[model samples]
Target chain A: MNSLTTAFFIAAAMILFAGCYMLVRSHNMIRLVIAVEVVMKAVTLVLVFAGYSNGNTALSQSFIITIIVAEVVVAVVATGIAIAVYRNNGDLDLRKLNKLNG
Target chain B: MSASLATLVYAFIGLPLIAIVLLNLPNRKFAEKLCIGTGLFVCIVQMATAVIAVLLLIEFNKASMSFSQFWDMHVADDAAYFSVDFLSAVCLFCIGMVGAVSFAAAGSTVRDKILNYTNMMMVLLLGMNGIALVTDLFSVYVFLEISGIASFLLIALYRDPVGLEGAFKYLVMSAIASAFILLGSGLLFLEFGSLRFVVLEEMLQAGVYNNPPLVWLALFFLVAGFAIKSGNMPFHGWLPDAQTGAPSPVSIMLSGIVEQMSGTYATMRLIDIFLLNKFTVVNIGMMLLALLSIVLGAIAAVGQTDFKRTLAYSSISQIGYIVLGISCGTVLGYVGAVLHFFNHSTFKSTLFANAAAVKNQLHSTHYDDLGGLQKQMPIAAATSVIAGLSTAGLPPFAGFWSKLLIIIAVWQTQGAFVASVALLASIFTLAYFLRIQHKVFFGPEKQRPAVKEPKDGIAIASIALSVVTIGFGILFPVLLLALQTQGVL
Candidate 1:
């Protein structure tokens, strides 16, 4: 593989790992949402790189745009639920959201 | 004939959009009053359309019929279009049946939120229909998101603490799954320069890709993503929580159709296009996952105290059967898997409807709060028995024939040990369901206020689904004979 492609792959992998780390480490609900967004951004980078490598940048561009739109809606809904959870428990701590269990 | 087929195919996507538009065009009060009727109308039409399309396709001796709604966009060589074949027709029918049941239950359970419920239900139906009809992987992702969003909002509609928690958990896991799926598809697109199923299938069959390792990596991500979406064993933490926390009607929708459409259906399509009759390692991997889910989900369900939670875990187990059938990679296995998918929707919807009935009358579905309900709620009790027996794969119930077919296919292909393991798991299914029957219906009477049967839409929905389950089970042999006569078996 070319040096440019290698660099892109490393960057995407690093971003993915960082996002996953945040997802595992965060104690706050809003931070979890941000972590999900970060992961999605990494996916976006991969899609863009894939398209560029394949000489089909336009299709990948459209795909990325659609992904952005869908992820935004997901973020809105996640934040909305998080806000509702906060109102119920008076905090955004992830540990407090465990009422249902086996 | 083709023209009529096109119209019928279009209805699956068009009717729901029309219903959404008409419902919202009126004023808020008017929409609220008309929402249930509109929802039922859309669902019934969709069910009828699916059956008719399937019949027409058969009569015309065609494998599938493709159609577009607004305008024909065949300008490019590989522009995406929607099509309906036997498999998708079956899925569409399941979506319609389950959507109808959800709407019926919602009339009683979600009276105040009826309008919002109907709106989101239509969107969910639209999304599922898109998933069933779309010809490309990217389109599947789009429809998955649409349905995923609708379900998350449905779970959080009441915004209660538990509902919010369920929705948040579902959203987080689902988002991660989507990232995995998109990355996989991106990797595929990088190699193939197209996302159409037919093109990818052809390319894979020709075996001319430059980057074989990249293809395997893509497959890995896709499998993991879909496994998560389907709530298979290891990735099943959110399923029970979401199902248990959602309101009863929404629970019916989630367990009945949403999870199957967004997850298992995609997996089936992926297998059809990518792994069918090849990739034995992937097939074995999927089979192992299915076995794990089947054994563990049933064992776990045996210990749950709550009504919805037990059924949720049971759903995980039942879905495992469907995946097991798929992983066999034979025509018989595919047929068995599709039939099992249909049976699961019918019986699971009936069970959830019974849960709604109990919750409505007693206001609690905990084992501690339920006892001797059979004497009072005769219909729910009776239907639950039928549905539960069907789930346990007893004779003369719909679930039995499908499970038997799956086990036989596994035996023929994967060997006796795997088949025997699957067969033994049914005993656990029966054990847990009997526990439900004993704890919730036939145990010693609790000294509490006398409860009556829920004289509402939920009761009617459960009865109808129970009838379908019983009818399908009894008629399956005739169907097999007919298929044999046609040289299809």
Candidate 2:
């Protein structure tokens, strides 16, 4: 692979790992949501790199736009649920959200 | 004829949109009153349209028919559009069937939030129908998100602690799955410059690609994403919690159709297009996952004390059977997988409907809170027995034929050992279901306030589903004979 492709892959992997680390370490619900968004951003980076390399920049741009829109909706819903959880538990900690265990 | 098919295809996506508009045009009270009826109407019409479309496709000897909802988008060679084949037609019918049952249960259970429930249900229907109809991978991701959002909102509708927690967990897991899917699809697009299934299929068949490792990486991500969506064994952490924590009607939707539509349907399509009879390693990997799910899910269900949780675990097990059929990579296996998909919807819906009936009356589904219910709730009890028996693959039920086909397919392709393991897993299925039957329905009577049968929509739905289970079981042989005669077998 070329230098540019190698750089892109390395950057994407770093971002993905950082996002996953945040997801695993964060105990707050809102932070968890942000972590998910971070992971999605990493995916977006990969998609853009894919398009750049494949010479399909227009199609990839459209795909990224749609992904952003959908990702925003998912974030909104996650925040809504987290807020509801906070209301019920008076905190945003993940430990408090374990009521449905078997 | 083509015009008529297009109209039918349009109805699949259009009817739900119109329903949403009509329900919201008036006052809140008016929407509340009209919501259940409108949902039921849309669902029944969808069911009819699916059956009719399948027959028409068969009679005309067409592989599939494509149509756009609004504007024709055939300008480019690989532009995305909607199409319906036999597999999608079957999925559409299953969605309508389970959606109808969900709405029926919602009629009595979700009285206060009826309007909101109806609106979300309509959106969910549109999303699932989109999944069934879309011909491209990116559109599948778009619809998956749509349906996933609807389900998360629906689960948290009451905003109870358990419901919110379940919704949060489901949201996190589903978002991750979507990321995996997007990354995979992007990699595929990088290689092929297209995400349409037909284009990908042709390219893969001609074996045209530069980087084989990148292709394998893409396949890994795609399979993992779909596997997580479908709640297979390793990635099933969110399934039981979500199903148990959602309200009963929503549980019906989640277990019966949503998981299949968002997860298994895409996997089936992926296998059909990309891995058809070629990717033996991928097929074996999928088969192993299926086996793990079937055995582990059933074993886990046996230990669960909650009714909905047990059913959720059972759903994981049944989904395993479907995946196992798909992993066999044979025509008979594909047919078996599809039939099992349909049957799973019917029987699982009936069981959840029974759970709703019990929950509506007793307000709890814990095993300790239930006993000797058969004497009081005969319809729920009797129907649960039939449904449970069907789930265990007993003869004279729809599940039996499908499970039989799947096992035979496994035996033919994988070997006797794998098939026998699948066969023995049903004993665990029977064991846990019998536990449910004894503890919840047929055990010793507990003295408490008078418990009468829930004579609401839930009871009616269970009875209707039971009839379907028995009827389909009896009629399957005739259908098989007809398929044989037509040289389809």
Candidate 3:
């Protein structure tokens, strides 16, 4: 792999790791969604890099489109659920929503 | 006839989709009847297609064929390919049957938001059917997410605190899983310059990838993604609540088909393609994960008192069994795993449907709140008993033989430690299920408010499933022969 590709890989991996960490660490619902989106972006970046390096831009571009569409739907539904939870419990805090414990 | 069978597969997928639009027509007065009618229509088409597919398989003596190959020239070169094989057809059959049952068993739950519920159910089924039939990695990911989104909405259908909370948990975790899948697929695409499973299988078989480290990383991500989606232990926190809180029919769809399609089936398909060539660290890691889920999930289920909650925990434990069977890396193990997938969907969905029936009757699912219900809801009680026994792996039931196959496979592959744990887990499974049966269905009548029999739709659904569970168990040799013919064994 070239230095530029290596750099892109490193950047994407770091961002992805950061997003996963935030997903585990964040207590707020909306923040969790943001963490997920961050991770998604990192993945998109990787896909783009793969496309560039392999010269399969069209396939990768289509994949990116699919990802974006799926991402939007997930985000919207998640936001809607978060809003519903907030309306019911009056907060977006996930810890408080633990009524159905083992 | 061949052309018609291929078209049947599309009709099986498309009818539900079309029903989604038709159910949403502007006419309000006939909406409920329209919903039921469309649901029944889709169910009939699904069953008819399943029977014909089986007949075609028998007539041809072929294991698998590309149903979409005839149309390949019409679509773009990059368009995804679909095949109707033994496994995919069986998966479709189960989905179609359970889906039909769910629609029939839905009773009053979908009555409130009939259009919305039917739409989401059809979307979920379409996604699931796609997952079973699609031939490439990207399509799997797309379809997995499609089904995942449908499930999240379905879980939140009640709009209550518990329901919304369950939905959010599912959403967050699924998002993480999807990220892993995307990253893994990207790595594989980089390696092969194609997203097709057949290509990846060939490369792995040939050991063509130059960078072993990246391949390992990609495999890890893929396995992790599928494991999370399957609701395996440590990654299964979302499942219990989601299963417990979703409206009952939604629970049937979620627990019955969605988890199987997204988790176990996907994992098996990938493992068949990638890990079969070389048993690496990924396989060992998966085995460890499987053992962990097997033991821990069973132990955890013993403590849950809520009815659906216990079933949810039981699902995790059972999933562990499926994973463990797959990890054994033996053909016998594969048979066990796939058979367990089929058996579990039948019995567990029946159990959940029964729980829904009970909930509908008594408006509660807590263990302490139910008792002596046999006289009142004999169908629920009887079906629950059969389903419970089948789930716990009682002899003469579908679950028993599959669990036996897995245990034998593990004994041969992983030795006595894992085998013993699996055997012991079966006992725990029986214990917990017995507890549910005794406390909820057989004990002295609790002086509670009287409730009516569970609705006929759910009762009929449960009965149909119960018969299949018993039939499959008794006729397991035939299934084995079919599997052998399909080259699965």
- Candidate 2 per-residue lDDT over residues A1-102, each given as its tens digit: 579987997899899999999998999999999999999999999989988988889999999999999999999999988878777779999976778873
Residue B47 of candidate 1: its Cα lDDT?
92
Task: Chain B TM-score per candidate, please.
Answer: 0.98, 0.98, 0.95
Candidate 1 residue A84 C-alpha distance from true site, Å: 0.9
For candidate 2, the share of real interface contacts preserved is: 0.87
User: What do the candidate models score in CA lDDT, each in turn?
Assistant: 0.91, 0.92, 0.85
| TM-score (0 to 1) for chain B of model 1 | 0.98
Q: Is candidate 2 or candidate 3 better by DockQ?
A: 2
Fnat per model, in the order given? 0.86, 0.87, 0.76
Clashing pairs in 1: none
| Model 3, global lDDT | 0.85
Q: Tell me the lDDT of model 2 at A95.
A: 78
- Tell me each candidate's RMSD, in Å, in order: 1.4, 1.3, 2.1
Q: What is the DockQ of each candidate?
A: 0.85, 0.86, 0.81
- Could you tell me the TM-score of chain A in candidate 2? 0.95
Error of 3 at B290 (Å): 1.8
Clashes per candidate (backbone, < 3 Å): 0, 0, 0
Best by DockQ: 2
